[model samples]
Target: MATPSARASCPLLLLPSPPPACPSILATKRTQRRRRILSCRAAVRFDRRDVLAGLTGVAAGELGAHPGLAAAEDASVVSCPRGETVTDKLLACQEAGQKPCPPTPAATAAAVDFTPPTSPMRVRQPAHLADAETVKKYRQALAAMRALPDSDPRSFASQAAIHQAYCDGHYRYGGPAAASKDDAPFDVHFSWIFAPWHRMYIYFYERILGGLIGDDAFALPYWNWDAPAGMAMPAIFKDAGSPLYDANRDPAHLGAYVNLDILNTGDTVIPFDPQAVQNNQVVQNNLCTLYVQMMRNKKAQDFLGDKFCAEYPSTVSSGTSGSLESMAHTSVHIWAGDPGSSTVGNDGQEHTGADMGFLGTAGRDPVFYSHHANVDRLWHLWATKLGRSNFDDPEWLDTSFVFYDEKPQLVRVRVRDVLDAAALRYSYDDREPLRWMDARPTPLLPKGTAAATTRRSLLRGAAPAPAFPLTLTPGQSVEVPSVPMPPRAQKTPAAGGGTQPDTVLVFDRIEFEPGRSGKFDVVINVPPEQAAAAGPRYSEYAGSFATLPRGGNRSGETAVVALVLPLDEVLADIGVGDEDGAVNVVIVPRTQGIKIIRPPRIEIRER
Candidate 1:
C-alpha cells in the first residue's frame, strides 16, 4: 500500500477537548456520564495553532440529531493514505477468495435478548496452573470441535471464521466499509466494541466446549501473561501433538518468557533468549504495564475505546484503539505469531504476520482464546477492583452483534447484555491483581544533559516544546522537556464525588498510511541520563502501542491517534505523585517509519 505522489492537504489534527466544568450542583451518575462523553466529543479547539471543525452537520453514527456532537461531511475518525489500502497481511484468505466472507447476521435477524446462562459461574483458571484432568478436558473439547465438519456452525473452523468474517474479511468488494450487510464489512476492533464483542465470542465458544465435554462447569482458561509465574507460553499450548498447540507461533518464543513489550522491539531485533531476558526485571515490567493499561486508562472511553454508540459510524469511522486492546493485547499477539523477528518467508508466502500476529488468522491459534480470556479478565477486574464504569450512552448499550451458541442457534446480543461477568456466569480463578500493583518502575538518577533531565533549573510551564508535526527516525529520538502534569484539585469535580481527578499524558496525534501498521512506545518522566532505559522494564516506560495493518482508515476518513497515559502510578513510583510541575516527554521509536503529526501534552483527566 504505497502512498500516492501527493497526500491529503488537510491532515487530521486531534486536539484534546477539555472535560466540561463539573456541574455546580451534583448530577446523577448517568447524567454525569453523559455530560463527560459529550464533553469528550466536544473537542473543537480553534487556537492560533489550527481552526477546529464545527457542528455544521451531525457526524454519522452518533445518535440521530444529537444536540452536542458536531461533524463536517469531510471529517473522519481516522485518516489513511489518500486511498484505502490493506496493510494487514492476514487478509490473504479473504483476498484469495478461499471462501466468500459471510455478511454479519443482521442484528435484526432472529435476534434475541441474551439470557444469562443458568449454570453456576465458571471460574476461568490460568492455563499454566490447570491440573492434569482440567488440561485433558480442555484438550478433548477442542478436539471435539475440530472433529466436527466445517459446515457445522459449532465446528472449530466455523468458530475461527466468525472472527475472520467480522474483523478481517468484511470488505470483499470494498465500497464504503459500512457495518450493515448491504454496505458491506463490519469490524469489532479499535472501538468500545472490542471488549463486549470478544466477551460474547469466547462465551459462546466456551459454551460449545462445555457441551462437547459434558461439563457445564467448564470455563475458558486465561493466559495469565501479567504475572511472573504465568509469563511463558503456557506449557499446555507448547506440545506440538496436543490440540492446543499452534504450529504458527514464533519458534524462538516457544519456551521463552513472554515479554509484554515484544512488538517493534521484538521483531528479531533483540536476540531470543528466555534465560537471559526473563528475570525479575521482565516480570516487574509486565506488572507495571498492566497497572498503566488498567489504572491509568480509567475513563470508560479510554479503557473501552472510541464509543460504538450506534450503527457503525461509517461517517465517523475508525475509533481509536483502547489502551488495553492496542497495547499489551496486541504485543502478545505479535509475540505469539509466527516469527516476530522475520517476515512470512518460511511458508513460501509473504504474509503480513503469522497466526496470532495478524488479526485475520488470530483465531486459528488456540492460545489466542486464552490470551483474550486474560484481556476479558482484566476488564472484569478494571470494573470491579477499580470500581470503574462502562459508557452509559444508549448507542453503546444498544449496539448488537450476532453469534452462534452451543445450541447452534443464531443469537444476537448487545453491549449492555455482556458488561457483567457475574451476570454472564463466569469469573477468573485468580482475580486479585496484587503482585503487579506495587511493581511501578524504579527511577534511575539522571547523569545527562541539564536540558534533558527533570526541570530543576527550568521554571514550571517555561520549557520550550518540540516543533509540531515532527517526523521521527528509528535511531533518533525526540525529548519534549519540562511538560507540566495536570494540576491537582482542578475545577472539574471528580466523577461521583470521588477524592481526586486523574492526570494523564497525551501524545496528541500520530498519522498512519493506510494498510501500513502503526507503531510507537511512550516513556514519561525519565531523566536524560536514564533515557537509554526507556522501555517496559522501567517505570518511565508507560506503554507501547501498535495498530495492526488494516483494510483502510475508518471510511477512508481522518481518524485521530491520541495516546492517553495515566500518571498516578508512575508519578507515585518516581516520588512525584503529589507534585504538578513539568516532566520530560521522551518519544522513543521502537521501529522505523512513524510520524507524529502533533506533539505531546498533559491534561487533568479522570480515569
Candidate 2:
C-alpha cells in the first residue's frame, strides 16, 4: 500500500496543472474509489517485475511477462494506455463518466515514492512489547508455575494461557503487504532457524520473568541434546505461560507418531546420500514457499491461533521428538538479507536474484522459532547416535555464527562453545532423551511390516564436507576431494583396516610450489546403509576447502594424502551397529596460499 505522504503529494506531482473546481472533494473521492477498486486489483497481480512499470507509467499490457501485474491486468475494467497522462484521463473520466487513462506522475519522485516498495529495515513492535507492568506480572506468574510437575500436561496448558494473554494484549493488524513481501509468509512452521529467532524472542519473555520473579537470576534454558539427559521436552515448553504449550498430549499417540527409526537418522551417519540430501533440500524449499504465503496474513489472531499450525498435521509434533523430524505447527527462521557468495540460489547461480531477505517479510508471523527448536533438537539427537565424539569432527570445531549474547553484545560462537552442558552455561535436566524410554526391541519397520528392508538406502549422500584444507601458508583455502576409497574386500593400507585411523583426510588439500601459492577442492560420497549403521567402517571422500594470499591468488601445485588405520571399534559401545557404510570426501578452497584445515582421523573402510 502507498504511504500517506506518498498519497498526499500525489496531487501536487501527478496533477501538474492548477487544481480543478472540485479538486479537494475529487481527490478524496478518487482516493476512496481507487482503494476500493485498485487495492483488490493489486492483491491478485503483484511481483517484482511490475515495480518498474508501476513507477514508469508504462501501459499495464507492456508489463512484459512481469508476474507482479498478472493479477491486476486480469482484473482491470478499462484496459487502456497506462502512461504519464493516464492519471488525468482517469480523473477526467470520473467526472465525465467515460473511462480515461490513469495518469503517471509528472515528477519521478512522486512515482518513486508511491511504488510498492520493500521495507529493508523496518521494525514493527509486537503488541506484547508494550505494558511494563503486564510483563512484570507475567514473569512472577511463570516462576510460581515452574514448580508444577514438568511431566504434567497442566504445566504447559497454564503457561500457554499466559502466552495467550500477552498475545491478546499486544497484537495488531500487520497489514496487506504481509503476503509475498519476504520468501516466507507469516504462518506457523518450524525448522533449524526457529530456535535462534525464539532465543531472541524469549529473551523478552525472560526479561518479563526477571521482573515478576524478583530475581534477575532467571535464564531460560535450551533443551540440551549434547547428551541424552538433556534431550526431553523442557518445562518451559510444557509450561502454562507458553502460547504453544500442549499438556493433554496422549502418550500412546506420541509413541505411534514419534518413531525412533525416523528420528535418529543423523546426517553424518549417511554423510551425503544424494537422495536424502535432495529430500532435505525439498523440505526446506517447500517450507520457504509456504512461509512466504503465510506472510500475506492480515490478521494476527489467525496466525497466533492453531488454524495455521494445523495445515501440516503430519509434520507438527507435541513432544520434542515429533517437533524435530517435522512440525505439525509452523516454526521458521528468516535470514532476511543478502549473505553474499555463501548463498545458494534456486537457479543454482553464484548471484542470480534476491535470496536472503526473503524470510523477514511482513507475511511471516513470529512463531517460526518454537517450531525450529524441535528440529534443532532432533539434529542434536542424530549427532548423539553417531557418537559423543561426533562433535569432535574437525569439521565442526571452528564452525562460526553471529548472535547477540546475554549482555546484548554481538559475538561469534563456535559449535564447540555449546558442546558441553556446563560450557553452554545452561541446563535442561527436566527434558530427557529418547533413550530414557524403551528402544525398539527389533528393527522397526513401517505399518504391516514385520521385518525391514536389508537393502538399506542412503540417508545423507556425500556432497563435500565444509572444512577447508589450508596450504602450509597461513592465509589461503581451496577445495579438496579425496581419491575414491578402495572396496572393503581388497587388502590395502593397514592390514585388517583399510586406512589408518589416526591419519586425517584432507578432502581439499592444496599443494604449494616453490615460493608460490595454489589450491583445489575434494568431494566425498557416503552411502545410505552405512550412514544408518553409524560405526566407523566405510569412508567416502568428503569435500575440501582452501584459500590463497591476496596478491598471489592463483591455482598452484597440488598433491593427495592417503592414510589407512583401524578406527576405534567402539561402535557397539556407543549403541551403533557394526555395519558396512561408505563416505566420499571432498575439499574446496576459497583462495590460494592458505593452509587447509585437515580432519583429525584417517580412513579404513575400503575394499
Candidate 3:
C-alpha cells in the first residue's frame, strides 16, 4: 500500500539501469536490504486467497519459470508499504494550517446529525427593479466597486484580493525540510486541493456580494434558462456591440466551452453526436480537461470565467428539459477528475486535485451547488412526470463532507440536507417547463415573440403581454360565461377505457405588476361527500396559456386563462392540492394583440 504522501509528488523519477543477474547469494542479500527499507514504512499482509487467485490466472510456462516464488505464492505476502513519507507530509500540512484530519476511524464511526433545522421564512425586500434603467444603475455600481484599490478592504474586489494575497501567504504548501519522497509526482489522489481552495474562494466572493448589496435585502437573480429564449445572452450581460459580447456565445458558450476544455481537454468542437445534444461521456471528459487546465495554469477564471456574466447556474434552467444534473455532475467531477489523471496542484508537497478523491476538488467548486440546483430540479420534474416524489435514498443521505468555516473550522455536510432548495435559500424559475421526455414542441409564440417576451413590461405590475391578454386592466372586471362540458367517451370493458378523475386546475390568466399584482379568486366549495378527504396531498400542477387568433376557442371551450392586472403590484399567489394527492395546473401567458408565449405551471402541494 503506497502512502498518500509517497504518491502526491511528481511521477516516479527515471530509475538507474539494473546490473545483469547477480550471484544468488549476493542477490539474496540485496533483496533483504530492500525488504528492510520496505518493512520500515510498510508491512506485507498476505492472504492465501489472493495468491491463489493470481496463480490461477498465470500460464503454465510463466509459472514454471519461477517455480520457487510460485510454490510460496499461496502463503507468501506481498509488500504493503505505508510510506512514512505520507505521514510526514500530513504532519507538515497540519503545521502549515492545512485542513485537519478526521478524528480517527473509531471516533468518526458514529452517525452525524446532518438534518437542517427548520428554515425561517425570509421576508426579503423585493427584488431591485431590473428594468433597463435599474440594470444600468446596478452595472454602474459594480464598475465603481471594482475600480477601488485592493487595499480598500471595504469593496468586494478588495476582499477577493485578500484571497489572492494569501495564496502566496501562510497558505503556501511544502517547506524546506519537506522530504523528497513526499514531493513525488502527481496522480488522482490530489483532489483535496479543490475542496479547500474553492471553499475559500467562494467565501470571498459571497462576502463581496454581501458587501455590494446589503446582505439583508440582496438576492442574486438567476437567468431563467428553461426557455430557449432565456438561454441566450441577455442585453444585461453585454456592453452593447462590444467585442466582449459574442451573441452566439452568451448563454451557453462561456461556461460550456470552458468546462468542455476542462473535462475533455479541448476535445471536439461540434457536438459528439449531432443527433444528441450533449452526450454524457463527452461531457465528463470535457469537464475533466477543463479543471486540469485550471489547476495547471493556476487560473481560476480559466474554469469559472472572469466576469459576473460567466458566473454559472446564476443563469436559470429555462430550457425544455427542466434538468441540469448531467451538466452539473460533469462540472464537479471534472474539477476533481475520475480518481486521477492530471489536474493536480504542482506544490510538490501536499496532495491537491480531484485525484486526491471525490470530495476534494469537486466539492470545492462554487459551481457545485448551481450544478446541483439543476440536478434537484430534474428530480422534481422526474417525480411529476413519473408520478413520484422524494429521493429517499439512505446511500445518498449517508454521504458525508468536511467543510472549513471562515476560521477554517471543519464542519460536516451531508447529501440529504441539500435536497431541499428552500433549505438552501435559493429559488430558480423555469420559463419553458413543458417537457415530455422525447417531445420537443415548437414554441407556442410566433417568430420574434420569444425575444419580445424577454422585454420588461411598460405596465409596472402586470405580466408582460404580447399580442393577447391574460388579465383585466385595473378596476375592470368581466364575467367569463360558463360553458357546458362535452359528453364523455363511452366506457366499455372491451375498450379498457375508464374515467381518470380530473386533477387539473383550470384558471383564467394570472396577472401581476411591479407594485399592483392581480389575483384570481376561486370558490372551492368542497362537496359534503368529498370534504373528509379534501386535505393536503402532493399533486402535480400543469396548465398552459396560449394566444390564439381573436376568434379562436371562442366558445369558451378552451381551458386557458386570460386576465389583466394593474401596474404597481407583484406576482404573488398560493395554490392548493386536492383529495388523494391530485392537482395540476398549466399556464400560458399572452395578451389579445401581442404574440403569446406558453408558460410552464408552478407546481404546489398544500403546506
Candidate 4:
C-alpha cells in the first residue's frame, strides 16, 4: 500500500510547456468574452474507489419527510442581530417608524474564558489520501449525527439551522414582502471574520462528530480540490446509501474534473476529456490563480477581506469580498451546487441552489464541512507556509460568536482562540504538496505585437482612461484607457521588515444583476485583445470577483458591491515603474449579462 503522500503524487498533472511576461501588460485573444478562456478537465485514471476504503453502519432511515437533508429553517422567528450588521438597515427601520435592533455587545462581553489545549494534535488527512477505514469512520460519525431529531442542538438539521442564522439575517414584518438575506444575525461572508467564523463552526462540528463516534482523535478530511487528483467530488460523498450523499448536486458533474473558474455557462463548459491537450490550460490556470491570490495580496485587508463590523448583507455591502472568499472559494461553491434544480426557500417560493452553492443551505450537505475544512487549511497554509500575519486590529482579534460544543453546552469563542490550530489540538496533513506554489505564470503578448514592442512609447502615448458611468459592453472585454498612477510614497521601515503597503485597482461600486453567479478578471495593463485568451497562468492576471448566487425566485434585482485587486507585484513584474504615469485596467467577463455600472479608480492603501 502506498503512503498518503505517495497516493497524492501523480506524474501526469504537470504543465506541458509555457513562457514570458513584461512590465508592459500583454493579453490573449478574446473572440468571445462570455465564453471561458480555459475550462479544465483534470482526470485521474485510477479507480477512486480503490483509494477510498471503508467500514460503516447502515445509514439511518431518512428524516423529516424531505428526501434529503433539507435542514430547513422557519423565516418568521429569525431576527437580525444588532451592532453586527450595516447601519443602513437600522436607519431605514427608524425612518419607517420601527424601533432599531438592540446595540451590539462590547469587547468586554466577548468570550475570554477559552484557552488553547495542551494536548497533542489530531491531523486532518486529505479526502483522496485517507484509507478506507478513515472514510468509514467519517461516514459513521455523520450517520450518528443524522439520526438525531431536529429538536436536539447536536442533531444534523439543527446544526444546519445554526449556520443559516449566522450566515446572514433574513426576516419579515408579517407583510406581503418576501424574506431575503439582506440583513444578518452575523454577516460572516465579506468581513475579516470569514476564516475564524468558519473555523469555529467546523471545529464544534468536528468535536460533536468525534464525541458521537467515541473517538476524540477524529479529524475531518478536507476535499483537497487544490490538488488535481482530488478535484472532483470525493467518491465517498457520492454513495447513495452513505450519510454524506446529497441528491441536489449536478448529476452531470459527478466524477468530473472540477471547474476552478467557471462562467454562468452552466454545464456547457465542463470538459469530458481530462487528457485533451486543450483542457490542460485549466489545471495550470487554477494553480496560477492560487499563486496570484495568495502571493499577490499580502496585506491582511486584501487577503482576509475588508473590515466588516456593523455591516448588513444586501446587494450592496460596505465591505468587499477578500481574495479567499471571492475567487476560487466562490467558484467551487457555484460549481458543486445544482443550479438546475429549484427548491423551496425560506420565502416559500421556488429558488435555485442546494447543499453547496447558496449560503443559507450549504451546511446541509456533508460535503460542505469537508469543503470548508480545505478552505480553513488554506488559511493555515497562508499564515504558516507563506509567513503572512493577520491584522493587528483589536476589533478583529477580539471578535467572538456563540456555538454549541460537543458537550451540548452553548460556548462563545473569540477569533484570538482560533488563530493557532495547534493550540486547539488539530492540524492538517501537510504531506500533500502545495502545487500552486510553483505556478508563477509567464505573460502572453497581444497578437500582431512583437516582444520588441516599445514599452516607453506605449506608456507615454496611451490614450486617457475612459471616465466613470462607462457602460460596459456585454460579452466583451472592456479596457479603460490608461489611467494615471500616483507615484509610490517613500517607505518608513517597520520592525522586522514586514510587507509594505500595496498599490491597488479599486472600484467604487460594481452594479450587476443579483441572484445570478458570474465572474470577471482584472488584468492590469494587459492589452484588451489578449486579455481573454491570456489565461490565469499568465503575468497580466491580477484577480477576479465571483458571486455565490442567492436563493429565491426573485429576478430583475441588481446588486452593487465594491472590488479591489493588488497590482504592485504584477506591475513590478511587467516592469511598470512606480514613476509610470498610467496603467490599463481590463475587465474580462467570463459570463454574459454582467455589467460594471460604476467607475473604477487606482489607489494605494497602507495597512
What is candidate 1's CA lDDT for residue 391? Answer: 64
Instruction: Give candidate 1 regions above 4 Å deviation.
Output: 1-100, 103-108, 169-186, 264-279, 309-316, 340-350, 431-433, 446-466, 482-486, 489-500, 513-517, 527-530, 551-560, 568-581
Query: Per-residue lDDT tens digits of candidate 1, residues 119-237?
Result: 98888998878878789999999999899877677888878766654555333222233223222223566566678778778888898999998899898888988877778788899
Residues 446-544 of candidate 2: C-alpha lDDT, one tens digit per residue: 221210111121122223433433343212222221222222322236655542222123111113321111223222222222323221111221212
TM match of model 2 to true structure? 0.26
> Which portions of model 2 show Cα errors greater than 4 Å?
1-216, 219-387, 391-395, 431-437, 441-607
Residues 167-221 of candidate 3 have per-residue lDDT tens digits of 2111112322222222211111112122222322333233244345444223333
TM-scores of all predicted structures: 0.74, 0.26, 0.29, 0.74
For model 3, the stretches where C-alpha displacement exceeds 4 angstroms are 1-211, 223-227, 230-235, 240-418, 434-607
Residue 232 of model 4 has an lDDT of 73
Residue 257 of model 3 has an lDDT of 24
Please rank every candidate by lDDT, starting with the best. 4, 1, 3, 2
- Shift of residue 308 alpha carbon in model 4, Å: 1.0
Instruction: Give per-model CA RMSD.
Output: 13.5, 25.7, 27.5, 18.7
Q: After superposition, how far is residue 10 of candidate 1 from its true place, in Å?
A: 32
* Backbone atom clashes (below 3 Å) for every candidate: 16, 158, 94, 13
Off by over 4 Å in 4: 1-120, 171-186, 264-279, 311-318, 346-349, 446-467, 470-474, 489-499, 551-559, 592-597
How far residue 562's Cα lies from its native spot in candidate 3, in Å, is: 53
